[model samples]
Target: MSDFLLDPDVVFLNHGSFGACPRSVFEEYQSWQLKLERQPVQFLQRELPELLADARRQLAQYLGARSHEVVFVPNPTFAANTIARCLSLGTGDEVLISDQEYGACRFAFQFAAQQKGFQVVEQSIPLPVESDEAIVEAFWQGVTKKTKLIFISHITSTTALTLPVAQICRRAREAGILTMIDGAHAPGQVDVNLGEIGADFYTATCHKWMCAPKGSGIFYAREDRQDLVEPLVVGWGWGKDKTFHRENEFVEHHEWLGTHDPSAYLTVPAAIAWHKQHFTAGVRQRSCDLARLAVDLASQIDGVHRVHADRFFRQMGLIDITSLQADPVELKKHLYDAYKIEVPVIRWQNRTLIRVSTHAYTSREDIQTFTFALQEAFNQRK
Candidate 1:
């Protein structure tokens, strides 16, 4: 496996939280930063637009969406906030969300709903999901005539479940409800075709799964839905009327949000290239296999259970540790301080879960080390 640009001392298994970029990609990102420093005005004014355009084109092709429909955002949270804030929902209208959504995104929608007086409804997708169809059915049960939008996670952060977003999007379309997918964990971890999924708006973090720089993310809005949403920030992109050019609005409104750093966005193409060169389909599958092995081994321990079936997860898995006496916060701290293992122990509903994430750089030894450390921790607690 290719060596990732992660600290070797850290036994990192938290790819879901913040991705570690490849050394090559990091170097590429630094090169862009250096170029910007050399001639600030020329690089930002003369060169950035074309370079960003090329990056968008490459990313769009990879995502199976039109180049014009994609815009670089700092993160999925920002993109979700933009869509949530601009949505034209009223007091009586409802925005349906799944129970397993990322907390940051849920907060974004809640904040927006508070401002707009729209109701945010949570549709419970229970644990140990049997099949994709069952999940879809459970989510659909929450929809009503008052539903104006469906916001769901492509891959849940806390549960580490890969939701059938494409299926959900199709159903939402049939119901005449707009769909916005929070795909923070889906992009490089799995094959994602935004056009095929047919979501009205989708946001994904390249920083999480694509191994891009920390600020890299993409917001995709369908051609028809673009008109309904407005930019979160009004910058050079907005005209005197506080509106943007029809075709250019999506990119113009969202991409230039006060321009702190475009280096990460420019390096996205490099990240894509690095994944192509090192982490092929076979490599990704191997990583998933290792992650599954970790989950299986962890689940076999007493009082532990797998959060969902294999079909509901891809490169990561959540193992339920609710029966353990150890507090989730204390356990997480012990894992980090004692074993130098970095992973997230999340609390979902009433259950405590240990979310294990894997990537191309993860090895069998890494899994073994984690399992050994976990066993030791549990024994000590017992």
Candidate 2:
């Protein structure tokens, strides 16, 4: 609790939205910024390439990937945009995605499909999830001969459900379909092994679950699939014979992007160190327990029910609160304004749901506070 810089006044249960970085990691980020300011030319021109490479190597090791197969990006949205805009899709081709994906990343694909004359097909995966096998089979029902690519989330945003990406990736690979996994909510919350998952393209946000500074993320392309991707922005790394920042074309082309500030990217190692020290297996299990507690407490209220089984959720859980007469927007605002409880009220599949996230910094008392506030809010609405 003392290690993080989260607001003490608020019962913050919304860690899934944007993670809270520890003071030590934030200090490391600021130190990199200060170094950049102190000697811009020396840092950017002479030292940045090696520095970035070292940082990328550390991150790749953490993600269980080869250094050259991965590169740092500003966020997962940027990585999704790069992939969506560059993939060669045309008429008669279909890009399959689940309906539970994050909105911004889904929009990137939709926009790209519009431009490339391809169809974006979304498979509906309703809640009250049975098992990972059921989810994989339900999603696979949408696949057709025209399906060229499969894009899905490692963990869903609104429902906080962990999909069986590894299984899906395996099946897609066997069927010769390209796979892109949006792991925005993975990394810190769950164990991720890129090689085991076997996705051709994957992107994750270090700032979300990994608790790095904002604007930090990673994009990974398997060795054989790197040639399929081209740089979204043509900078110093694009033209042949031009002095490149990195020897790896996949990294050099996407990593440079004119260098607005690499501080967040460089601080990822510090964040990983902080996570290892503070978020031990026991601590992570406690966070999961708290998240489950939130869902359980809320489900006791009339018209509310937990969405998924305990195995389907990690540090976050979603409860359906559709029976409440209050609008989702007003309920969210009232919870924050009146109770100082920060959580997400989502409307997915025409049903109102509340998603609660518990991290290492979340305490039992905080969960109690949120539960009491939710009970009071519901009673007042009646």
Candidate 3:
């Protein structure tokens, strides 16, 4: 409980958002920042490449991927934007995405589609999901002959539903359609093997479930598909006299995204170490159990409904708040203002949900606190 730096007063239930870092990890982050400040030129020019390379090696090992197949960006949005913008989408080319995807990633694709005279198709995958097979089939229904890529979330943002990305990726390969997976919330919460999933393009945030510092994102492009993505920032990675190039075009092209604090990216190994030490299989199961408890609590409420099945969500669960007479915006404000509970009430795909995320630090008492807070919030509306 005292391992993390999360405020003791506030029952932090929004870990699916930017994750809270541990005291150790935060200190490690600050140390990197101090080192960078001490000798900026020496750190950035001479030592930073090897430092980043070591960090990438450890992170790639954890993610079950080759070190060259992945590179760090600021966030998943940056990776998505770079990939979406770089793709040569012509007129009538379609990128199929589910309705349950994160808004920012969807917008990136939509913006790219608009700029390049292409189409971004959103396939509806309604809640109360039956099975993984059903979800895969439902999403596959939207793929057409003009489909160039399949972009979807490994775990959804608003709904907190974990989609079967591997099944979709496999089917996409069979049909010769490229796959881009937005796996912002999948890394630490779920068992992820990029080699097994095998998407042509994948982006995830270490800051989210991995509990690393903010602004740490990982982008993966296959060796063969590296040509599809060009650098959003045409910096030292391209042209002659590149700082670090070991013949990995993907690493060579997209590694340098202008000079920024590399502290967050460097602290990934610390975060992974923390996760490995604390988050045992039993610990993870208990967290998921708490998430299920949230859905159960919502089910007991008069008007509230559980959004999806138990298997559809991991540490985060979404409970439908549509039946509440109050607006989702006011409901969120009231929940925070009146009760000291911090939870995100989101409206997406025409439904409102009070999404609750329970990380390793979350306790049974915190779940009970939110349970009481939710009931009080709804009762006030009446």
Candidate 4:
């Protein structure tokens, strides 16, 4: 609790939405900002290329990927948008995605589909998942001869379920269909190995689970697929005769998207170090236990239950709260206003759920307080 910069009065169970950075990591981020202000040209022009390369190398090694294959981006959505627009999928073509993907990333594909006259097929992955085979088979049902790519999440946002992405990626590879994994919630919460997952392209937010500062994320394109991705922003890195800033075309194209603060991106190494020092196996297990406990306590209430099997969850768990008969927006507001308990009340596929995220800083007492507030909120409506 002392390590993180969070409000003491607020019971924050929403780390999945936006991660909390530790004091040490945040200070490093500030130091980068200070350095940038001290000398703008030297920092951005003379020094940024190698600095970014070094940062990407560290991040790449951590993710089980080659340094040249990965590049820094603002967030996963930005990467998603880039791919969505770059792919040449017109009429008679299709891209497959699961129903449980992040809303923003889904919108990017949908918007591109509308403009390009391509079909965006969303396969339904119903709750109470039985097995990894079942999920793969169900999602594979939507893939047809016209399907060119598959966009899926490593861990779903609303349901908080970790999908068997490796199996799906393997199947896609055999079929020659491109694979893009939206891993916004998977980095620090679960072990991320790009080579093991075998995705053609991958995007994840360091700010969410990796505990990096906001506006820091990664976009990865496999060596063979790098040429398929076009630049979302045509900046100094574009044009054939332009001087390359980095070793590879992917980094050179995406790294310099106009002059913006690289502080968050530079601070990712500090965040990774902080994670190494503190988030040990025992600490991670404790966070997962607290998440399960939140679901267990809420399950005792009538008509409330866990959304998925415990095997599919990590530090984040989703609890069905539709039995309370209250609007999700209003219930979320009431929890914060009345109890100072911060959690997300999500409405997905007509089902209301409370998404509880547990981290190293989260206390068992905090979960209990949130449960009590939920009980009181449910009773008030009756």
Q: List the pairs of residues colliding in candidate 2.
A: none
| Candidate order, lDDT descending | 4, 2, 3, 1
Off by over 4 Å in 3: none
Name the runs in model 4 displaced over 4 angstroms: 240-244
- lDDT string, candidate 4, 209-288, tens digits: 89999999999999999999899998888768555557877888887898899999999999999889999889999999
Worst 10 residues of 2 by lDDT: 238-247
Cα deviation of 339, candidate 4, in Å: 0.7
- The candidate, 1 or 3, that scores higher on TM-score is 3
Give the clashing residue pairs of candidate 4, or none.
none
**lDDT (C-alpha, whole model) for all candidates:** 0.87, 0.91, 0.88, 0.92
Which residue segments of model 1 deviate by more than 4 Å? 240-247
- Tens-place lDDT per residue, model 2, 16-66, is 998899889999999999999999999988988898898999999999999
- Alpha-carbon RMSD of each model: 1.8, 0.9, 1.1, 0.9
- lDDT by residue (tens digit), candidate 3, 187-209: 99998999999899899999988
TM-score quality measure for candidate 4: 0.98
Question: Which RMSD does model 2 reach against the true structure?
Answer: 0.9
TM-score of each: 0.97, 0.98, 0.98, 0.98
Better of 2 and 3 by lDDT: 2
* Residue 55 accuracy (lDDT) in model 4: 92
